[model samples]
Structure formats: structure tokens, C-alpha cells
Target: MFRFEKYNIADWFSFYRILAVPLLLAFVWYGERTLFTWFLLVSYSTDAIDGFLARKLKIVSARGSQLDSVGDQITLIMGLIGLIVFEIAFMKANYGLILLAFIPYILQMIIAFVIYGKTTAFHTYLAKTSALLQGVFILWLLFFGPVYWLFYTMIIIGILETIEEISLIYMYPHWVKDVKGIFWALKDDRRTIRKKTVKKNGV
Candidate 1:
């Protein structure tokens, strides 16, 4: 996964978030709320930066998509850990909703991996929105306090995004990357094209 020879600028940006995970955890371990929140902010910023650079430079690839997804999952898990440790009261208050939203997401991962042998890179608009809301909600809670509306919005968007991903998995029947959403998936050539072979006349 850490192929220095093949990594582009955008991939490195995604890698930054992954590398920051331990630092974020260290801050959490030390009970450095301010430091943890600030470092976590950097991680979220890279999430946006990597995606923008990938699109602007036309350097997107399946590997890049997978790297970005892994970075995202790790960052989010770390962020949740930070939240649980630093904001124990808030997390306890909302544990049920958090767990409820996570179940479908976990199930989606299981189904996708079982069928596609890897994580889905759908990158659908809904997924992007969900990530955005999640980052915002988590950061807001850490920096300020709990905002019920934002929390609720993030939960709803997350569930919807996970459902869309599961649906796309069934639609493609194989791995694909950078899909915009369900509408685009319906028209994706990857889903429609069939393999063909041409034999030499001598054969």
C-alpha cells in the first residue's frame, strides 16, 4: 500500500491523514483536547485537499480511491475514539444513535468485501456529503459542544450513503471506482460492457 515509487501528490495527501492517526491518538491519550481537535482538523482538511487534488490533476485511480477510503475510515474511527475519550458525556448521551447508524455501515462493509473482495470506491455524491457532515459534526462537537441537529443530520446522511453503496455493489457485480451516485451507476459502462476476445485467423 505504501508504494513510494507509484504514489502521486494526491496519494501522499491521503497518506498524511493515515500517518496522523497515531498523533491524534497520542493527543487523546494525554487528554489534550485542544491539540487533539486541532490535529484532527488537519486530518479533515487533508481529506478535502486530497479529493480536490485528485480531481483537479486528473490523477484519480482505483488505488488512490482505495487509499483515500482507508484513510477516511481510519480517521473517522480515530476521531470517534477521540470523541469517546474526550467527550465521554456527549458520547454516552448519544451512544444509541451512533450505534444504530453504525450497524448498517458495518453490514455494508461486510457485504461489499465478501462480494467484491475489497472496499467500495463508489465516491457517490451522497457519500461525499455524508463524509462532510460527519467531519463537521465531529469537529463542531469537539471544538464547541453537542449540536443535536447536526448530529441527527449526520446520522441520516450516513445511513442513506451506506444504503446507496450497498445498492451500487449489487448493481456493478464487481469493483468500480469514483462513481457519482446511483443515477450514474445505472449508466456506467463498467456495468454494461462485456468482455470480448478476437482470435487470430491462424488460430
Candidate 2:
């Protein structure tokens, strides 16, 4: 049902992330840490490239937004797997904080699904920064080892972003494709438009 009218270059880049999951998994299975790190870096890079391309080309659409969100989630999961597999000691040391950070995020996901059925694709500015930090931290750890300062910063921003996303989900009556953040969401008229579309499309 999530058909795209046409796939743009940005969509293709996102699609690459989805399609790369198996390759990434294979790397993990084979314990190819170096290869996996390089590939994960590429997958993370695509996230930035797709967003930039979509904005530059003005090819953004609900379908593209959904695709990008899916790609982002997939890449994040794969990267996390890499982190656990390769940096077991670090993850063990910081497992408590990681679990703590995930609590609100997990609840946020539940809240979104219960209210909206699917995850919100708000793509807030805070989320972008959090994602950038995640990628940087993962790559930095894999390449040069963990930096506690960066790890702590990433956790803080990530939790903050999750809170912002949850707030946006409740602020809007229906799923929104994009939002700047809580501040802009305050005055975002796009909510009305998205609500109408959701009602019409039953999405």
C-alpha cells in the first residue's frame, strides 16, 4: 500500500540502506569488524546524503519520508549490532546507561504505535543531530575506540530527541512527515493538512 509515484535519487539512497542489511549481517556473522565498520559508515553517510538530496531537489514526499525513516531505523539497528559484537567490553561497561536511555525511547515508540499505528516520521532537527552523533560515535568507537565524552553526549541528545518526538506525536492529531522540532511544531500549520490527509486516506 505504501506505493511511491516515483523513486528519486534520495529514495534510492535510502533503499540502499534497507538492501544492505543482509550484507551487514553477513559481515557480523563472519566477524569482519573492519569490513562491517566501513560498510556501516557508508550506510550512515547515505542517511545524510538522502536528506540533503531531498531538500535540494525538492523531491520530498510522504512515501519518501517513510522510506527514509525505515532506512534510518535499519541502519541504526545494524550499527548497534556492530557495536555490541565488536565492542563488547565497552557495551558491558556502559550497559546500564544504555538501558536507561532506551527506556523512554521504547515507551515513545509504544505511544506512537498505539496512537498512530505506525511510527511518526517527524524528522525533527533534534533527531537529526542525535542521529549524527550516533553515527559519529559508532564510527569513532570502531575506528579509534570509545570516547566516554562523546558517548555521554550522544546518550543525552538521543534521550532529548526521543522526548521531542513523543511530544510531537501528541501535539499533532495525525502523523507528520517532517517537523523542525518542538518549538516550530508549536506553530506548524502542516498538522491540519496532515490530519485531513490521514482521515481521507485512512493511513
Clashing residue pair totals per candidate (backbone < 3 A)? 0, 0
Candidate 2 error regions (>4 Å): 1-5, 192-203
Find the candidate with the highest lDDT and give its number. 2
Whole-model Cα lDDT of every candidate shown, in order: 0.89, 0.90
* Candidate 1 wrongly placed segments (more than 4 Å): 1-3, 194-203
C-alpha RMSD for every candidate = 3.9, 3.4
Writing each residue's lDDT as its tens digit, candidate 2 over 10-67 gives 9999999999999999999999999999999999999989999999999998978999
Give the distance in Å from residue 1's predicted Cα in candidate 1 to where it truly belongs. 9.5
Q: Positional deviation of 139 in candidate 1, in angstroms?
A: 0.3
Q: Which ten residues in a row have the lowest lDDT in candidate 2?
A: 1-10
